[model samples]
Target: MQHLRVAWALAGAAAGFFLLFLIQAHLFGEGQLVAGTCEIVTLDRDSSQPRRTIARQTARCACRKGQIAGTTRASPACVDAQIVRSRQWCEMMPCLDDEGCDLLVNRTGWTCAQPGGRVKTTTVS
Candidate 1:
């Protein structure tokens, strides 16, 4: 019947639109950019010579997925996102009430210090 044909056509159009929406979302979903502060170290380069450190600088950066603002041994820089995630703590709120959390030097781990003089240290594996 004519009504049945029109209903089928409408259903097909709706399905097509849904499929298009999904494809668009999949392609653009990971395009988010994150902003952070990073350190920059400038080096003096000479031909046939080792690079020498010139100055340490800081900058605000907008990094895309898979990259993060972090610091290197020599200076602040944009590093792999995984490294940032592994090095960061206290942001995860692992400390309890009446406790203070601090990120360890070199970002090797974190420590939670309680007001009672008890401390818990967690190292990154």
Candidate 2:
């Protein structure tokens, strides 16, 4: 029957749409796919920081400490309460073997990169 085939096609299309909606909901949480009216904002990142790992946050302190890489839905955290209170500077030579470190003016600097990279060093006043 011609009408029977049309009904079967319509049923398949409905099932496909339902599955798609369910997948989107599972990936982005419920009601996130609703049009407009979302609370998202960009964060303040250091100008010198790499652009490869930058993200926005929906709320304050939504990410873990020292997370420089994240998605648009989540924000990255840099430094926790304990670390900020202690005022402890991160160690130098964070690179593994085959990587070079830039000591610059201070023995404990935070600039490290691959070998043969341009580095800056100036004497303290």
Candidate 3:
């Protein structure tokens, strides 16, 4: 009957709307996503003394969803090293200019200092 058809259409519309809301809530909710900071440090090696300090900076880290594809190794996104890990025993490279220095970002998200300042921190996808 006409009335039966109308009722079915209304029910379908309501169900569609409810499903959309649930999906959006799961995707956009803040708690569902994780974000954090990373620091990188660069060290100098050539100095007369054994120990030297170089530069430092911070970057942002976020959690992503995916399964490991091929090997036992985890995805880079999940286990990327911070700056500190890279510089633990590395020597420092000379600065490019007064404001420049040889540096890299560590797993912690910090960069070694350059002549002018530390490298700017940023986020990657």
Candidate 4:
């Protein structure tokens, strides 16, 4: 009957909407995902001696669904997926075998310096 078909369609629509809502809630909910801890080592430059001391540090970070844990200059925190994929400082192997990649000072980009003194820079948002 026409009424029976209409009821089934309405039920199917409602189920689809519910499924969508559940998926959104699972991804965007308040609960955060732990990306894990990271250990960092650096040179301590403030010392008066000519030789720098090695400074060791650890950081525990939590990131959202699309992010991963990373260390910024100031602290440990979440980093965007695109930045990780881009693999700054030659991690992505963007340059030729003989060339080198250097992370820019601003931390928003990188430069591939060639043997001929040519520099190619790419910026990420």
Positional deviation of residue 73's Cα in model 3 after best superposition, in angstroms: 29
lDDT of 2 by residue, 1-125 (tens): 99999999999999999999999889999445233123344554334665343233342333344432211211123333443333222321234455554444443323335467643221111
Candidate 4 per-residue lDDT over residues 3-87, each given as its tens digit = 9999999999999999999999989875444454333334332455454332344444666677665544334556666767765
Candidate 3, residue 58: CA error in Å? 8.0
* Structure candidate 1, residue pairs in collision: 39-76
User: Would you give me the overall lDDT of model 3?
Assistant: 0.38
Compute each candidate's TM-score over C-alphas. Answer: 0.33, 0.30, 0.32, 0.31
Candidate RMSDs in Å, in order, are: 14.1, 11.3, 11.9, 13.3
| Tens-place lDDT digits, model 1, residues 46-72 | 345444322323445566567765544
Residue ranges of candidate 2 with Cα displaced over 4 Å: 31-65, 68-125
The per-candidate count of clashes, in order, stands at 1, 0, 23, 0
- Give the TM-score comparing model 2 with the true structure, all chains together: 0.30
Candidate 3: 10-residue stretch with minimal lDDT: 67-76
- Highest-TM-score candidate: 1
Off by over 4 Å in 4: 1-89
> Model 3, which residues run further than 4 Å from truth?
30-60, 63-83, 88-98, 102-125
lDDT of 3 by residue, 40-91 (tens): 2333334454444333323234533332111011112223233223432122
- The true-structure Cα RMSD of candidate 3 reads 11.9
